[model samples]
Target chain A: MFEATQLNRRNETTQKLFRLALGGMTGILILPVILILGTLIWKGAPVISFEFLFTGPTKGMTAGGIFPALLGTILLVLVALLASVPLGVAAAIYLSEYAPNNWFTRAINLAIINLAGVPSIVHALFGVGAFVIFFKFGTSILAASLTLAIMTLPVVIVATRESLQAVPEAFREACWNMGATRWQTIRRVVLPNAVTGILTGVILEVSRTAGETAPIMFTGAAFFLPLLPQSVFDQTMALSLHLFVVSTQVPNMPEQLPYGVALVLISLVLLMNSLSIALRMYLRGKKKW
Target chain B: MTAMAPIPGRSTERSLAIRTSKLNLWYGTFQALFDVDLDIRQGIITSMIGPSGCGKSTFLRSVNRINERLGYVRTTGTIDVMGQNIMDPEVELVQVRKQIGMVFQRPNPLPISIRDNVLFGHRIHNAGKRDARSEEDGIVENALQTVLLWDKVKDKLDKKATALSLEEQQKLCIARLLPVKPGVLLMDEPCSALDPKGTEAVEELIWELRGEYTILIVTHNMAQARRASEECIFMLMGKVVEHDDTGQMFVTPKHKETADYIEGRYG
Candidate 1:
């Protein structure tokens, strides 16, 4: 009886200890996210202004605006979306809907899963090597966009595949039973049903590309673009690369300038993130029953 | 029993909605169906009844070539629908299935509104007749009325289909099939998932649908086979045990196995 009572007491203590440990670990994990956002607000809020958003890059020692950087970011993210959305979704449909449980399909899926886990900086290096050097885009906005497009392509494909897969097999079978051709079933039934999921994935990939700094840094992020890109052929300075140069690597700049660039970059990312969330919510609202 | 069966020696007024000659099916190396010969005549409910894994559903699917969609499944021999060989590589299954509609065990409605669910195939095959179809919303209304779902879902035509009750959904599936204007309806245990009331509704629909569509049903319920169907094909171990009119098969089955199955001796 004593041993039994002792065992129960020990188990209770251990269980309570585990709970405390887990709770603490969760707090620890959340600390960085909170701290990151908190610091961005603290350091970046003061520089927030209408002129800072609208005006062009500074001349000489003037703390000027980030319009050129902002333009590059917008153009590059848009280009990436245009490049990846259709191809990623098509690849997803092929994998999820068309590919049966065969070895070739399995291998292709495994390859995609592995590709998603490859480090972001390596993707940048590959972009510089392939797009900038080989393709001879020569550090232009087009090259940066292409690099970012490749980086986010895998994310879009995986998300799209999952969404397409979520469209119940019953729906496809229903289409088939109705005498719909295979392609017709995909177009009329499956694709429309999975559109929301596909849209959500595209938004997330767009978010990812919007803030990516390292890849653009090597491939197309010009140190100081005097003018906003009027065409894809022009070199451009994206906000992420600007934030990097201003905050950490600006060798001969005053303290407040980095804060201003950091503010603009943070705002851009937060906007993209919020837009992605709103898009998904709006889609969910439309999904009746 | 032999005397009861008029068993015409030589008759040639051949009329079959669907006919299978030595139907065999394989899933990889394992055979799922044996050499099975069967015919479905018009204006009657023919049921394939057997235990689980007995390929009753397989035979039903064979009639419409639905099994061919499965990558591992392979079928041999000829399944003829309306004198066209469904097994032939040249035969367009899309066209064949357009004439033979199916309602599965579970109700599956297109995720669109109730109106769209009924008119999906109608719009597909009958596009040139759209204005006529739209004017005759009566086809959708009448189909729903026949399935006993018109009263339940009459006001919610534009509402999402997934919100319906299971019985209503099942009936909607029947209503959905109506717009396709199929001559043969295949049901793979349509009422197996339903409650008593839903089962009764489906049974009544099967009875009500006598002239327009010939039905091939797969059922585990012996009483359903007896009450709902006119012709019965009893199968076990992937082989047909007996084939007869439901009344005769229930009363005086020639095969001992058939009698055992019908008499609740064993499946």
Candidate 2:
């Protein structure tokens, strides 16, 4: 080992380098988010207009609106939430409340964490093959929703599970002692206490579903779709897909409207995020859990 | 059941509210309880005092089967509450739990208004429907009054339960337990998490409710055992070392271990 005096210079330099490296890493990780958000506001804010928002896709370099896309995003997210909320939350309840500390429960939990890390594009492909080709539903809103549900299932499931876990064991005991049946306990005490957390998870998943592009593109994406969906089977437009189209395809002409859509999309994401935060806050406020 | 209130002046009946015979529990392969037996009489306060991890809580959970939810924990032997074997497959745990309520070591108030928190058990059990407003009001008042929390919390009943001080929250939990009209009350170191004043408040409440139901309390605080209980049971290494009148146990314990513990020889 070197003497204290001999190591002083190198140690000092190493500490400075470590600090610099940390700072550098933080910037690198956060740069894209800041840039994308900044660019969206800067480029998209001006394009916000009532008229542009009401119209449909235009050919070549003409002014168009995000009404169809917005409608589609809402529908797709709603359907996905509808499909996944019950199933994912139920799975979470099983994992946390019902499942034992056995290998089976552990395996299921591990699979869910892994599912969350799976690529969105892979989910898209699964949706296309399963819902569209094998089920013969055709490339439509139904396919897109199924794909998005699978994509967001992990988020909602984990959130629900975490919320359920957050509940004190005493609460469950209290419920049981109150003569509540098992399902009754889950429905009354456990679920009600866990609701805010579940809702938060749902809101977050909604935002995630809204932002996805490649998945939607894979299942039911149409670059210039103009129609509103009437059913799950009807092909529809969505906000995220439209934003991708506007950002990459029509960056030159009527630039303001796309930016407007970008701003709207950003607002939508922020709104969902804020909603998730609010639900979680409400969940936390009830205190017992 | 006419659970409008505890109905004061009703003659306290003599009965065994809970009985346990040769109870044993295992955490994985580790034995937590070894052939333990206990009896909780109606309308009396029974205190369980023991060192930490001496199966006091393990014994408490067996009362309501909350231990069943914990992983790899197994139990053998019979636990009878109100002459019903809770361990019987046909016996409904949730139903059994309702008959015997519990207050935890830590105060746990649901994230809701004080009113809703008090009404929690009532609403869940549907003891009285929402349309039964008069019964609801009476039940709420009775439960709150039993815990001596009525006057302080009445005005702010609509406020969130978390808004209350820690002592108030503990009282609210007691109030919640009241609506169940339970035959027996199990308190697992209920005052352990409270300050001296809060502990005194809970101790007073326990005495106040004694005539209405049986009470079993687990405590690590020796002075509390001396001050608050009539009959006290002491356990060591998951075995009941001694059981006798609280004053006698403290003054002249039956076992040397109990005497040594009273003198702080070994905890």
Clashes of each: 0, 6
The residue-by-residue lDDT of candidate 1 on B1-267, one tens digit each, is: 101111222234546777888889998998988988888886678988988889899888887788878888988888877666777766677767777899999999888888888888877776424646455578779888878788888899889898888888888888888876777889999998899988998799788886567789999999999999989999999998889989999999999889888888886
Docking class of 1: medium
- For model 2, how does the per-residue alpha-carbon lDDT over B1-267 read when each residue is reduced to its tens digit? 212123233345656677888998999999999998887776788889888888887888788887877668899989887777788887766566667788888888876788877887777677435637678788888888888999998888778887788888888888898776787888999998888999999899898888677788999899988888878999888888888889999998989889888888877
> Model 2, clash count?
6
Considering summed lDDT, which 10 consecutive residues are worst modelled in model 2 chain A? A57-66
Fnat per candidate:
0.68, 0.66
- Local accuracy by lDDT, each model: 0.82, 0.81
Q: Kindly report which residue stretches of model 2 are placed more than 4 angstroms away from their true locations once superposed.
A: A1-49, A59-67, A225-230, A237-289, B1-15
Interface alpha-carbon RMSD, every candidate: 1.3, 3.0
Which pairs clash inside model 2? A44-A259, A44-A260, A47-A256, A177-B97, A177-B98, A286-B111
